[model samples]
Target: MVSLIRSALLLAAVASVALVGQASAECETIYVRREVRDLADEEWRVFVEAVQKVMKTEKPQEADGQAMTIYDDLVKQHLDYQDKCHGTPIFLPWHRAFLKTFELELQKAVPGVVAPYWHWGFDSQAPHHSEVLSHKYYGGAGQGEQSCVPDTPFKDYKPTYTADGMPKCICRQYDDNGNRIAPFSPIEELASIVENSPDFDDFSSRIEGNPHGLVHNGIGYGFSSMSSPSDPIFFAHHAFVDMLWAKFQERE
Candidate 1:
């Protein structure tokens, strides 16, 4: 009986050590990405400030010493890669990689900063009026025929490059025929897309077609074209799309 008890105790100690090792491995692999709504006001402020800093900081000196900020680099990247990244089989993964890299850049400025995602489905009923567009956030609708944004953090933002490779003020066109742009696809619609899609290609295609394209059209101007990243909301919108893809992945 004594020998049996000692064996049992030794086995228990070994099991405990193994369990601790397993937990340490799991901790090393696990990471958390938060949604836009989940972020506190302070967290959002930090993210926004980091992005603004990137926008102001110029790129490395070249032959011509181009006055390109990190923000300009991102815009140029999107403009250059839009054709390869959009409406293709690799669309979702490409954007996912872009957002991750962009988040890393943001974190370099403000440690622990994660890009926040906008849940457009939640505001599908009244996307234009959503708090995301409030003066406290991305600002209200565009003003005048050119649809130039008037009262937002980016109102004074002048990009060095656009789809046309020309300097222009950041702009948004939010209406047509005296009506607000169409609302984003609701959660129900997304649910259907996930359920009906048989593979990653089909799933991503559906997402890009509906919620993705609709949001761009709804925002108009820079957002409606390859120069979408020129608008800060572009990241938030794409992050939410990535979140939805993750949601679908969870079921698999």
Candidate 2:
């Protein structure tokens, strides 16, 4: 009887292990296609020309109004029109694709031009001394290093790409048995996603209120309210966050 009971326990343990392994596989980060490399020399000039047009009219308006109107109408509108992709959790895929499109468009418009994506990753080293997203007052370590831990797994963990050349990371979704379930909830799993990513957030504190708000002094200038476009990192940062959401949508 004792031997039979021991055998049963072993079988249960194995089953639990299998279930956990299966769960983690369910929630993994998905990568956006890196087709921004397709922009030809001629197209680059057209893109730059668009950028010039956009910059001239993108006046800051504190929180909202003309600046936002011009941004949505002239800049964002053009990029979204080109992506041809949509879906809720797919926010990052669309934005990354959109940024790439915008970059390529600018290059097409300007010729031999390269536009930079405002990277929040830089703040991990930027001299700012407070956490960017945290309501608390901790920023940088004062030595130009991040004092807070990163929430986004990609920020610190680099995933091995698939044969098709797509990057992958651990997804934030988990099942009842502590296994990850795919189609992860963006609103639900965002905090875990952020906390897990490395070199992403300088603000050690988790974001409260709206996860979508702009940074307010955690890392010098973190995210800002998006009504206006004064903050440079706004679009890129949101785009990064969106990417995490898209990955959560695809599960094994």
lDDT of each: 0.74, 0.33
User: What is the lDDT for 190 in model 1?
Assistant: 87
Candidate 1, RMSD to the unseen true structure? 12.2
Candidate 2, which segments miss by more than 4 Å at Cα? 1-53, 57-90, 112-114, 118-223, 229-231, 238-252
Tens digits of per-residue lDDT for model 1, 135-214: 77776676776666777677667787776632376677774542376777888998888777786667878999977899
lDDT of 2: 0.33
Q: Tens-digit lDDT track for model 2 on 222-248?
A: 121112122223344445444443343
**Count of backbone collisions in candidate 1:** 1
